[model samples]
Target: MEEKMIVLVAFDGSKAANEALSLAVKHAEAFKGKVVLVRSLKGGADIDSEDIQTAEQDLAYAEQFCRERSVPFETHLLVRGCSPGEDIVRFAEECRADEIIMGVRRRSRVSKMVFGSNARHVILEAHCPVVTVK
Candidate 1:
């Protein structure tokens, strides 16, 4: 509580992601810290122009929310060629984040395995504590 908290939020424009953002903002506001919102894309064939546009829109929306709440924030659109989980984990370490906030969608075990759960990967790989929002 003595030091400013650096809260990293994984945002993807979903309801769950929005919930995570809200939580991050509350934490930052209470601690007089900062919030870092990150959206990850693998680029290339994995993502299209529409995806890029949506990411921008989502980032803008989150930015507006933070501005309205007077919460200090940063927005990062990461296009590194890796899984979202890896990007998030690496980014957190790079920024030396105090905590990570993200959302977990209910998925069948098979689906998670096929799609690769970013939350699971992040929980296992991140150096910082991760808080998940439904």
Candidate 2:
């Protein structure tokens, strides 16, 4: 039997992330693929239990959304004090994803260079094709 095509999406409950999630669902429908939702927390001394709880809620919402669309999906949380971009790319690689979908916000080139953009990093580092939704 053929292996299932996987579409990985980076989500954080922001508008852009939600947009990415929606697009991933559409893409999954088009390709008969499964969706994987990933949420990354920049681990730090400031991160508290409440933060993890909130992240879990966001993932739950994402799961419900996929279920409403009748799309098969799994959610993952990455919190190893790593950059979101790195975590996202690592998860995609581990899953052997066929494609990655992420949300990006407009940023000046200089600002992006100074304060790295996760979307940009994922685009550069992912092993598969990446789709960005603003």
Candidate 3:
């Protein structure tokens, strides 16, 4: 049996994240791979009710998006007191994903220094190759 390729997409409901999802679907279709959509619920706050509901809604949207494209996909919500970047990388590793797709925003150097960059962290820490869409 041939090993299947998995594409991991980090989604946060942003336009750039939508683009990343689209690109992941395209890759999945082209490579006959599966897509994994992940959303990180940052911080250790007892998994806020609103956040859980929002994640459910977002995952539903992601599922529909994959269904429309006829792509095989699964969704994961990470709320284990980890940063989004850490969650993304850890999920990718756990899934043995062949590639990771993420949305990146243009941040000024000062802002990046002050706030840190999740995309940057993922890019640096992920085991597989990362594709970033702005």
Q: Write the per-residue lDDT of candidate 2 for residues 1-134, one digit (tens) a residue.
A: 87778999999998888999999999999999899999999888989898899999999999999999999999998897889999999889999999999888898999989998889889999999999998
TM-score of 2: 0.93
* Per-residue accuracy of model 3 over 1-134 as CA lDDT, tens digit each: 98778999999888899999999999999999999999998857466799888887888899899999899999988887888999899989998999999999897999999999999999999999999998
**Could you give candidate 1's per-residue lDDT for residues 15-118 as a string of tens digits?**
99999999999999988999999999998676799999999999999999999999999999999999899999999999989999999899998998898899
Clashes of each: 0, 0, 0
TM-score computed on alpha carbons, candidate 3: 0.95
Residues forming the 10-long window of minimal summed lDDT in candidate 2: 1-10
Query: Model 3 segments beyond 4 Å from truth?
Result: none
Off by over 4 Å in 1: 1-3
Alpha-carbon lDDT, every model: 0.95, 0.93, 0.92
Tell me how far the alpha carbon of residue 111 in candidate 3 is from the true structure, in angstroms, after superposition: 1.2
The runs of at least 3 residues in candidate 2 whose Cα sits more than 4 Å from the true structure, single-residue gaps closed, are: none
Give the 10-residue window scoring lowest on summed lDDT in candidate 3.
Answer: 42-51
